[model samples]
Target: MTSKPEKVRWGILGPGNIAKAFAGGVAHSRTGTLVAVGARNPGKAGLTEAFPGARILDGYEALLGDPDVDAIYISTPHPSHAEWAIKAAEAGKHVLCEKPLGLTAFEADAMIHAARKAGTFLGEAFMYRLHPQTARLVELIRAGAIGEIKMIKSSFGFAMPGFMPEHRLYAKDLAGGGILDVGGYPVSMARLIAGAAAGKPFAEPDEVVGAAHLGQSGVDEWASALLHFPGGIVAEVSCSISLAQDNVLRILGNKGRIEVADFWYAGGQQGGTGEIRIIRPGDTEVVEVKEDGWLYAFEVDAAGEAILGGKQEFAWPGMGWADSLGNLRVLDKWRAAIGLEYDIEKPAKRVNTISGRKLRAGGTAIPKRSIPGLPRPASCLALGFEDFRTFSSGAILLDAYFEAGGNLFDTAFVYGSGYTETLLGQWLKNRGVREQSVVIGKGAHSPLCYPDVIGKQLTQSLERLQTDHIDVYFMHRDNPDVPVDEFVDAMDREVKAGRIRGPFGGSNWTMERMDEAIAYAERTGKQKPGALSNNFSLAEMLEPIWAGCVTSSSDEWKAWLTARQMPNFAWSSQGRGFFTDRAGRDRRDNEELVRVWYSDKNFGRRDRAIELAKRLGKSPIHVALAYVLAQPFPSVPLIGPRSLDELEDSLQALDISLSPDDLAWLDSGSDQARARA
Candidate 1:
């Protein structure tokens, strides 16, 4: 006996024009049905008329909370797609968001992460790809109908005669541009065709060169890009909002060429013959393909099947997570080349009004420690600004940290793609405490870890931090391939130029590398590295936390730092929650903690910490932090607190102190009194 197909109930978020097409597609699909339509103004003209059979909801959140809705079709504007898609996933509903998936690749990453965490399906809605004609095109290319594919040319453009500045296509704040809007189509099609040549689902371009014509509204009216993919495949793609183009996709190979006119509209609204033309030396042939339903219906059916199959992403002709990410990454590079930035894309300043409590700078009297070169003292702990997603949410925790005596903010160029720095900068400017705070800026992370990126990223970081100079600058990562002297010289340039005033150092750098850098700086009469940021705590890391990460908690590393009297900014100094009761040998389910910190030796250290905490009337976690602070060399631990309560709990660690004998006993798991003797 055969089982009946599972019925997937769909909800439409932001009942806009595209949403009507999606709802119509779902109505035509066998496995999917539209049950609800949500809009901020549900009573607006044409909304109810468009989705007559579906329940009209008042807001997008209402659709997410609807139990009968199994999945949501997010047709919101580009800027709002990421937020609503994440919320829908968190609410246990699968999502099919409109493209481009988000305003930036960073935003897309966040959406993918949320869906994966929720174990829900997420697919970007590029309706053309799912159409039968696209599949036929891919099959023909893979079959070598066009032998040894070498070049691809695709364009999507239309003329907006009376362009409105506030319209999404022209509004920079809404991430409106030809590149992010229509440009994605040509890019996706090019990548898809290139992937077919390589026998893979998709392939990313190795190089991209883009040019754009920015209109009066500060958004791209027309843009073009040259993309170089692997396997000697090259493509030239273009899109425009104010200029009309052929809107065709042409793939040229050594032996032949194939062209598809009105590629994006094929098998969709036209309701006509879908044609692919092949041109060879002797003859030109036309292949006509027929479609059964709207182009959007294919993606609807595909998403429903994936959800029923318990897959987190859609398969071929459908967008997987990596495919979405790869496409967005290409767009990011293209935008960078053309220098396109959106106001809504920037981090907004948020006011913290938790319980109507106003933020006052100094409330808890946090202890400050002196650094080598800076005249101002930094807080013993640095506030890590990576976890909070929104500026207001982060501001609440930032306010609490400041009230508790935190003047040092830890941020990096890679942190939320500079969103963290933007948030901290807005908070500093809003609080009018830029001079009072110590900003620890970091740059030159992986993939961009070069001599030029060191200076360029630092300049962007400084601008984001809203400060004239960074108090302490750190290379976020190290590349051993580059000469140590070159890295030193790049940093020395910044120091001499007054962009960095207090100290400069390396994070995740080994002791040997640090010595090499410092010695080279000394020999060249340049500024030496004054601090080192690495993992150091009671629980030893079984492996590097991330690529190129280093741990300084080993006995040899500790001895080196002590001998040199070098300041160490210890990250994950509290053992990354290892000292808490939540961690244990039997708790193998917490894979990250278990894989990083679970060991026989670390368990013994935890036991000793518990004993010390009992004697001092403090928590074991607090005692673990105190041990790092009580080290022989200058130690400042970075704290990442997700909430106000967690921040307050971390602050209590400042009051706990450990003597030399106590530290030795904790490390050696021996009696303190005997160790002192």
Candidate 2:
């Protein structure tokens, strides 16, 4: 028994190039039908004249009111993509909004909210994602065809100087620009290939630094950026609106590389033309594919199946609204870095949804007032963390932090066994905000820092972070065996490759070694480390607390910092919760940490912290955190808060101010200090 293919009647808004393609696509598809076309003016009504069987309405509202239309395909200029889509969704029409999903994630959020409220299906028209070829590519990568994809290089752009101003590609009012116009293709492709390592598309580029060739209208006609994905997969993505390129997409892995030709959405142009070339260490083969007729048809079918099944959006794992938002977030950052702003999005549209459910950037108020060892006034949002678990709290906290006003983030690869780096990668997605954020990445720790670990770990860290480069990368641990020159050379290579953004630094290294590293970079004509992340605290440690622990809390260290212009992001700025009493002195209970950095001196410091905690009418943790924030240097403490309550509790210390005398009294002769005396 053969079941009849279900038909989804579509109402297309805006009679443009995309609309015609979609109309022609329905004519060629088996699962959907185009029933109506809407135009803003009668003069432009000719845009849909080819669809003789379908009615052409004078306005979008007329088309939405048509009972026969089950859905609306939004092919309007970029600026109107969200508005009309939300209207259609509110009218209970399934919506397939065109790519660059919306002018911003904020706009996209509105449309999504409306769809959810109206109980309608709303999907971003990322036609390429629905193509059979893209599906196969995902399968190959997931199957490890390219063992552990470590890097991806892709580009899509073309020159168009002779184009008309009314063309959406050149109109600022249309939200036109290379990044949002064509950048979406390569950026989205990068997200597809990076997979779970990135956790989401638009892996919050740990850092997005780039140069652009701007057009007469101030739109980026050509721009280049590097996206670092988790586990060391770097996607060097570029795009140009004014010139043409191969539009090649390549995913580089440890074992091989996967290259796709003309990887964007191509429907009915060439029925069966492109090939995906797989090149291995020793073998090379080109796999060909036939377009499954119309590319948009697949999404139409997916939309139909989803709506019929009572889902608000397509449930495809990677193509969900979350993924769409991620892509937009990255695009948002790329545009921001290049100074590209669309006038149309100046005052973001109001939420039409019942929740008045607009997307608001969360986490307000700087956490610096409460954090310690910070050298400068805290930015709106500063991402604070230790080691790799980069994405999890660091990334999640950063998102919340940024929504609140944070702009700085810190990370090191060895912390989460790379999981942290991976997490950071996920946090950086389609927000059109990169320049405003601060990223600190570290390399060379554990099973890795034997000199041989430098290059691979840094590259891997970049990929995990999901940006082309690291804003600030550090040497996680000093390897005495590796000549300082060797370390400098490796980092120098990345600097040249444009993999590490300006302002590099060191972590867990002594001041002497840091001086040696800075000298080596200078002598070699390479970039010098600009920041330092060390065990700096309000309380001092006399002797080694752990087997390999290092601290730069000495007065000499402060003098050195004052002399050097380098910035510092303090680690364990809160003294490992020893000051908070959240961590008890009984090592038997917390063996893991006790074995790492616990000591009798730290316990004594903990006792004094408790006393001070009482005097301040604050928690020991808050006093400890306040102590770190009291430093005169430009420093920020890396706090580890597991819940919002803890985060809020930590945040409460922001208003607590300590005097220089208070600092002196707390540290002058605490038990740890007396022992040293």
Candidate 3:
């Protein structure tokens, strides 16, 4: 690990109260430094009134677009976080967006995806979780100091009746509400505590019930929610702006209980000064842990390290985009239960027309299975590992899939820095399964799209695969401006050079483009693309993955594939897990993922999938995979499983056989019914 600096360069977005205090905290930190201030009005930045020598920028765009700005700290309103953070990530800047990363989980996923694509860092700025004292509390709780946690109670509120309702804190248009503003703190803490009890980084509540006192501004003035964990751990949390609260957190277990005072904004007005106490059964004595100084500095350090070290997201517990999304999903429900609906949650503002797809909260790892009837491949290699360099898990997943009669390994040069290919190479070497297996490789992914990249990436991939040529190759994207002849000639050259053999496919390309390419190839006497790799789940895309790129799943595209006898390696065959409602909402960074993977139509499909899963005695995820595998044409679904459990669940589609009537029924639901109202 690289040693943390005595001071990290920091840029602040928006000049709000949180930003002010955060800047102050950074000024006092021995390991952080405030470098720039980005506000809508340059004159209003007033950095001289806070931290001297901190330059003020004219706008948020300038802060992000500036090459000198190493990392950005977004303290803007919730709605703006998603827009600005995405722009920042695209500009190659690391981001630390405020709590509740975006209004929804899909938004957070988009932000994460953007950061991943950019090779930058991103994290929800939940300063309190990073306090040294929070870690100590978790350590004690994990050590059984609190003994099997069973219940939790926490609250954060303050009465300010005389305050104007237009302030950002009370403005519904700004996503103001007790749940998002204050409830998030306690809820995050509960998840952290619950996850620690189960030896995981996080926990999804099984159920959430909410009630709130609404302010005239239409936001939650006071709100309370109940969270049920799988292992009998139930937690109650409350927050309010119209009433004073204890701002305390307490957890009860079989053998003991733990409590924290002022849990959300733990540190005192100036910085860290919060306290936690543990009370064991039959012991009146209390053991307390004290935290010192402003906690936001830790978030700054995390973003700094990620940017300088090239990490996709922060490693802190209870502070990832996923955590933020989970917390918001619960909060959205709690607010709804309380009749505290922000303008943002209104039907007009949501991308999906439906109200909200109900989720099965709670950490229930139900076994997921794939439906049967996929075209017989040489073998089904599990092309699912995320980190290909890590031999233990990656190779283990491959072996597990191969041992189960799967012999075709799918990979891309862009995956894991060609680490996936390297791992596959080493696995082949170790098992001597090279000739027995078929290799599928893809290239030209984001950030690596040079035409020359095809040959260069292919050569490196072959070297890593320990093979002279690939059995199947794919153009991961289509450059609309790069004429058909150019692409065909390049692939044909590779085929003739013995670098790639047999068939080639197209991913993220449209039918017109594919048709043109094949036409060009046929006229020129070169091999045309023999496969299509686009998203072909039960739910199709409403828009292109990116702004300009279109998916090759339209009728025309499908017809082209069918006409030419081209098989499809359907990317996201399981609708990217949306059929199970596993695909979350948007976030501040990875917006593209949210738009492409988790739209309203997809959510609607997932809602129906869940109902069908329950009716069929199968997991919703399995239903989704089955839907993908049920396609009429010759299709091979690409699955990204992180563990044996996920791999097994994704494989459930192998057995399910959805009739044409069943598929049509699913696709033709009240189109409006799919709208998350």
lDDT of each model, Cα atoms only? Answer: 0.85, 0.68, 0.70
Better of 1 and 2 by TM-score: 1
Assess candidate 1 and give its lDDT: 0.85
**Candidate 1, superposed: residue stretches over 4 Å from native:** 1-5, 270-272, 347-438, 441-464, 467-557, 560-567, 570-677
**Ten contiguous residues with the weakest lDDT in model 1:** 347-356
Distance from true location, Cα of 578 in model 1, Å: 22
Count: clashes, candidate 3: 50
The number of the candidate with the highest lDDT is 1
Q: In candidate 3, which residue ranges exceed 4 Å CA deviation?
A: 1-7, 267-274, 290-292, 345-677
lDDT of 2 by residue, 56-126 (tens): 88898899899888888888888677668877887779888778667766567656766876888888777
Q: Rank the candidates by TM-score, best first.
A: 1, 3, 2
Q: Against the true structure, what is every candidate's RMSD? A: 10.6, 15.8, 21.2
TM per candidate comes to 0.66, 0.52, 0.54
Sort by lDDT, best first.
1, 3, 2
lDDT (10s digit) by residue, model 3, range 323-363: 77688778766755775546764423432211121111121
Clashes of each: 0, 62, 50
If both were scored by lDDT, which would come out higher, candidate 1 or candidate 2? 1
User: What's the TM for model 2?
Assistant: 0.52
